[model samples]
Target: MKIVKVFLVLSVLLSITGCSPLVNNNPTKVETSSNGSYKALLFVNGMELQSVGHTANESELVVGEFIGAVNEKVDIEIRPSDELTSNYLEEGTEIYSVEGNTKIVLAKKENGDYEVFE
Candidate 1:
């Protein structure tokens, strides 16, 4: 009887603990513009993630490491690409500029929503 009760309690505890978010060791992927003149750089937990740009119907840049826990923050910086000297006005290129840089900070909430801060 005592062993049965202990087993039930342990099962409940395991289920509760499993409700938390899981950590991802891999980096996040982001879509970019095919003809855009900017690239986005991402930092998570103070580490620069490995990212690459690929060309499909459009261009995409995979950036950032996934946030491992709630309240963890990710920072992104958009800069002008060296391939293009001048900033191009496009859908994804709006974030890039030569006069000033664009940066955003995002924090993961318990509800799985990301709070964005400039």
Candidate 2:
């Protein structure tokens, strides 16, 4: 019985380890926007892709900078509308406008598609 239990545990561990998480797992670097008012970060494969400005906004917001990965680049514009939340890749192009100041992250899947997190 003890051996069977150990085998089950081992099997579960192996399964979990083999499975990949949905987001990138790399370390990220941050850079402030050229205007010096906002910051942005770029993430690659679940890793900290890049860093940008503070995650705060007031009555108005504007597009800051563009987030890129390796050779790929995505437009990181600030939304004037407070309803914007985070950006995501819907069909082909990125859907920049979001709902609110929800923490947003970007990830590229194995299928070569972009995904946005909030």
* Residue 25 shift from truth in candidate 2, angstroms: 1.0
Error of 1 at 24 (Å): 6.7
Best by TM-score: 1
Residue-level lDDT of model 2, residues 2-116, one tens digit each, is 9999999999988887785633343232233567643333333343323232221422433323343333333444321112222222223232222443345433444643344
What does candidate 1's lDDT look like per residue over 19-93, in tens digits?
Answer: 755532223423345775333443333433222332211222222334333222222323322221112222212
Quote the positional error of residue 47 for candidate 1 in Å.
11
- In model 1, state the lDDT of residue 64: 34
